[model samples]
Target: MESFSLLLRGFSVALLPWNLLWAFVGVVLGTVVGILPGIGPALTVALLLPVTYDLEPVSAFIMFAGIYSGAMYGGSTTSILMNTPGESGSMITALEGHEMARAGRASAALATAAIGSFVAGTIGTVGLTLAAPLLARVALTFGPAEYFALMVLGFSTISAVLGETPIRGLVSLFFGLALGLVGIDLQTGEARFTLGLPQLLDGIDVVVVVVGLFAVGETLHVVSRPHHASFITKVRGWTWMTRADWSRSWKPWLRGTVLGFPVGALPTGGVVIPTFLSYWLERRLSKNPEEFGRGAIEGVAGPEAANNAAAAGVLVPLLTLGLPTSATAAILLAAFQQYNLQPGPLLFVTNPSLVWGLIASLYIGNLALLLLNLPLAPLWARLLEIPQPLLYGGILVFATVGTYSLNSSVFDVGLMSVIGVVGYFMRRFDVPVAPAIIGMILGPLAEQQFRRALAISQGEMSVFLTRPLSATVLALAVLVLVIPSLLRLLRARAAHQGRP
Candidate 1:
């Protein structure tokens, strides 16, 4: 009941005239970016970070929330029509959605994708509304030791899950940790990795790193690759779903929401996992499983719902624990820091309006996406027609201008270009950049908590193990790091024993 009242208050804030306009603008921009190949929400939000510096925090975050959810909605259009996933989360959608499009059911495929996204996004938002506060309350009990342990869990889970191999993920994470170590030591008042540059004293800005890696690096990558001709499936026939289509889709929407929210809330959960799980689950539950590869509406419905729901789920830990599970969540964390606000239990108490208002905007955003996407998916699909050179040229200009605007530092622009080159190499090598981003953001916090824990224990190393919660969380982190290697070893041994 208290949550309900607070939500009503949130709605009051979100419905403000200015806030509504920002929400509209954000969703519109997000949909545009999401339709264009290679420009996801992370890059869009990163580019806008500098632009939002003077904006009100509540308004900025509301716009960001709209962009986040709207991108999820828009990615489906690209997946269904062009067979190109605008975001990794939408990759699963391409399998059946493109197939449906090919078979001349483009309208049905798009309709189910849009409607399922609406259902799942709404349900997931409700879950976030109910769950985040509870999680925040629980997190309020944590000590420095517990916080450190929790961050370690985040580090391990992200490093283990993101790349093809855990080694590659850890490599990416270590790179970020190295960057985090560049700034002056807060406690010791000493520079570690400054290399005698004055700008190194304050460290590289998160915004610069984000723009370099996502915008500049992605642009360079796309420019380097040969452009391939893509076939766009035209929307034909009635755009509305038939009665049979509705029956096949509703259950999958509910199930995808059920699977997405909890997984997304977990430290290890991400959109890719839940989306793939939803696809697999839908296949198993389908009465006509064979239709899965051949344009089944269930295939389009389930994964699209899971993709959006999981996007919402990623916000839960981000809000409650200040833990980011995905690259976009990490960037959002940077936005919070730009305003000198920290996400976690205290954020809710200190900034209830911001917290609740942000949540409420999500509801509005989801509704806006449904209404906007259904009627205008064809128009959104036309975005694919944009010339690559023009699109990438604009991104480079925005990225350069955004980086330069941060302190008007010509040096920062150079730094961004250098990092952009590094980012290009990281992508070329298939090293997941998300771990690097998460690491850079969380590394300093982890170090702070670790030192605090030691101080509380009078330099005792056992503090992390002495506290029950800390011990459990640390043990879980270890498992996250170790389990995959153990499983691989077991598989190798089994293969050896079975000797071909």
Candidate 2:
């Protein structure tokens, strides 16, 4: 009840006419940047930091919250329609969503994405409001051992995304892990794979990889195969979700929210793991698992929900413990510092208005994003109506510009083209690119956490087994890897016996 009362007070502060206006402006700007490739909420917020020097802290934070939530919603647009993800969190969405667009189900994909985002965002905000303090404490309990174990659990999900055969997926995953190792070693300061290039010391940007694989590679593949039919399909009408679609999507949205929030609240967690896990879970629970790569609505719905919910979950630690789990959270922490305000438990007491107001604005921003994006889903899907030559020409230009904007480096653009060619060959060989992306992201983090744990325990390998949480998670990871193989073997044995 006390929490309820405080939230009402927050609503009072957030509902001010000026505050509402700022919120609207922030969401609008966020949506635009999110639709464009390469520009994510972190960069957007960082760019706005200098301009908001004179603004009131509460108003500025309210606007920031709006941008954060709005960007999560907007990213799914490009992922669904163009096969390009505006943010890393939306990358999984492009896999199935673009396929749906190819099959003339773009409107349905957009609708489910938009609605799932809203449901998950709103529920996640409620989690933020009521359980932030409790969840933050839980996040604090995760040591390096536990975090490493968690990464192992994430690694186990690679089986779900591995397409066609395990061998192909392992090849792609190993490639990604190799790419992830290209930068300088953090602890020793030794350059591992820079190849004497000054630019490579900082490591390859994930945005460059994503854009290269999806947009540039796709454009090249299509251009090379001019005799094949056009990829885009014509829309029959602006049909939203049918009754069947609603039944299929709602459960995934809820399950995704369940999976997304707790993981996101962890200091070590980010949007990637939850979204991937959600996709895996949906595929496992799905009635028609084969439809996953071919545009399953549950595939679009679950990961999108997890993506937005994880976005909200990132705030729990930022608000309650002053921990920045994700890049956007880190930038928001900078925003807090710039205002001579610190985020922690005391901030909730000393500046209840700002804290609560920001939370309240998330609720407002979610509703605003839903209203803004829902009506435009059909219009956005119509991007496919353009001639194929013109559409892909624009994608190439857009991909190049977006990749270049990361560091303003011409070399990065060249690197992206190289990766794009590599992506084309992966597609040609029917290798699953998702495992590569997963490995590229998680491999480095897992290595870091593993080293940290060993250093803390004086190089004792038993630390992971000694801790109950770590041991439990490691066991789960083992099960994730072993269970499917066991099941497959049993079925094969049964078939052989019956045939004899």
Candidate 3:
């Protein structure tokens, strides 16, 4: 009942005229960026940060919520039509969505993906509305030791879960930690890795890093590859899903929501794992398993739903614990910092209206995406016709301008180019970019907590293990790191025995 009342109040705030207009603008812009390959929601939001500098925090966040949801919807359009995914989360959708398009069932594929995203997004928002506050309330009991342990869990799981191997992920994470150390030490106010540069005192900006890696690096990668013209299938039939399509899609949608939100709400949740899990589960349960690689509507529906749901789930940590589990979430955390607003237990108490209104806008954003995509998908498909050279050139322009505008510094732009080069090499070597971003964002906070916990314990090393919550969380982190390697060894041994 309390949640219901707060939500109703949130609706009142979101329905304000200016806020509604911002939401519309954000969703439209997000859809456009998501349709263009190599541009994604994080980069889009980072680019728009300069434009939103004057807007009120509530309106700005409402707009960001729309962009976040809209991008997820628009990404599927590219995946289905052109076998290009605007976001990594949409890769699973392309596996079967493009196949459906090739089979002339493009209309059904698009419809199921859009509708499933809407369903999963709505459900995930509800979970957010109910779950975030409860988690925030529970988090009030945590001490510095517990918080440090929790960060350890996040660091361990994020490194292990992403990339081709844990070593690659760890390398990326350590690199980020090293980068995070470049600024002055917060406690002593002493410079650590300034390298005699004035700009290093405040630390490298997250926005600059995001644009460099996502926009510049991705453009370079696309330009390096041989350009192949994409073939888009024309929509030949009704845009609406048929009864048969609905029957096959509904179950996967439900199952995907169930699988996605919980995993995503975790402190270290990333969209990739839940989406893959949802896809594999759907394939295993499917009555016609052979249709998986061929044009299976269930495959497209399930993974798309899981993708959006996980996107929503990322907010759980960001809002309740000030923890960012994904690249976009890390960028959003930077946005919050721009306003000097920390999102955690205090955010709800200090700004309940902003918190609830953002949540309410998510609901509205999901609906707006569905309505916008369903009628205009044919037009959105035309975006694929854009010339690669022109598209990449525009991305470079935005990346440069966004970085320069941060402090009106040309040096920031140069720094961004250097990071872009590093990002390109990271991509070439199959290193996951997300872990580095996460590590850079979380490393300083982890360091602060570690020092605070030690101080509270009078420099006793056992403080971390002496606390029940801290010990348990650290143990869980160790298990997360160890379990995967043990499982791999066991599987290898079993395979060897079977072969003999």
Candidate 4:
């Protein structure tokens, strides 16, 4: 009853005029970003973090949620029409959607993806709403030690799961942490990393870092690639799915949603694992098995739904436990912290309305995306025909304008250029930027909690293991790190002996 009433209040907040407008802006901008190759939600969200400084926290989060959800939907347009995935999640859709397009069934492919996204998105939101309350109640009992243990688990998981090298991930994270520590110390008057640069005193602006890392990094990434748009087959057919399409697609959509949520909630490779699982399922269950790689509707519908559903689902842990399940989630986690809001068990009790409002707005944002995409997909598609040089030039303009508008700080722009150079090199070396952002966002929070926990126990390291829940969580964190290495060693040994 308590949580139920709180949810109603959340609806009230989400419905506010200002929040609604930002929701619209976020969804529209997010979809545009999604349609543009290489400009994903993570990068955009990171870039836009600076703009939210003026927004009410609830409105800021609602906008962020819209961007996150909208990007997932926007990726499909290009995948179906151009055989190009605007976002990584859309890769699965390209397999089948592009095929459907090739068959002159572009409309049906687009419709199935749009409708399936709406259905799965709503279900995922319901899951978040229902699960959050119960999780919050459990979280309310945690002490400093437990909070510290939980944050450690989150940090370790994100650093370990993303990219090829855990060492690089750690290095990236420490760099972010070092950046996070640049401003005046909250606990002490000493400025640690400023090095007498006035801009360093306030810490490297989150906006500057985000815009540079995402927009600039991405632009640099694009210019380095091939100059021409590659040839892709044109789409055809009815602008809607047939009855046959509906019959085959519903069950897979549900299954994809189910499979995606838990994976999205864990500190794993976000949608990657769930997407593979959904694709595997559709392949195994399809009546026309050979039709799959050749462009079956089920192949297009399931993974696209799973991908969006997983994107929505990852928000659960980020909001409820401060655990980011993906690279994007980590950025959103950073956004929450920027507003001085720490998401955890205490969050539900302290800011029920904000959490609930953000969740409710997700349902609205998906509806907004569907409505926006259904009519404007062609416009999005037409964008692809633009020459690469001119297209990238416009992106560079938006990146600069957006960065400059937030604070009118020239230093921020300069910082963006420097980060862009670094980001360019990181991509060349295959060092993932997401883990660095995650480490930057979560490092300070985790470090503080860890020290707080020890302080409470008078520096007794045993306290980390003495509490049942903390010990269990810490033990699991240890297992996630160790089990993989052990398996790899066993495989290496077997290979050395030339055994099958």
Candidate number of the best TM-score: 1
User: Could you give me the TM-score of model 1 versus the true structure?
Assistant: 0.98
Ranked by lDDT from best down, the candidates are 1, 3, 2, 4
What's each prediction's TM-score?
0.98, 0.64, 0.97, 0.92
Candidate 2 regions with alpha-carbon error over 4 angstroms = 1-117, 128-133, 158-170, 224-362
Give candidate 3 misplaced runs (Cα > 4 Å).
237-239, 497-500
How would you encode candidate 4's per-residue C-alpha lDDT over 146-232 as one tens digit per residue?
877776676666666665666666666676777778777765667878888877776766556666777788788877887775755
What are the lDDT scores of the predictions, listed in order? 0.90, 0.80, 0.88, 0.79
TM-score of 3: 0.97
User: Which one is best on lDDT?
Assistant: 1
Candidate 4, residue 184: Cα displacement in angstroms equals: 3.0
Ranking by TM-score: 1, 3, 4, 2
RMSD of each: 1.2, 7.2, 1.4, 2.5
What's the alpha carbon RMSD for model 4?
2.5
lDDT of 3 by residue, 1-500 (tens): 78788988899999999999999988998888888888988888888787788889999999998888888988999998888787888999999999999988898999999999999999999999999989989988888899889888988888898878887888888888888888889999999888999998889888878888888778777777787877777777665788999999999998999899999999869888888999999999999999999989999999999988998999998998888888888778878878889888889889989999999999999999999988888888888888878988888998888999889999899889888888888888989888888888788888999999999899998999989999999999999888888999999999999995
**498 Cα displacement, candidate 4 (Å):** 3.8
Model 4 regions more than 4 Å off = 165-168, 232-237, 405-407
Error of 2 at 470 (Å): 1.3
Better of 1 and 4 by TM-score: 1
Whole-model lDDT, candidate 3?
Answer: 0.88
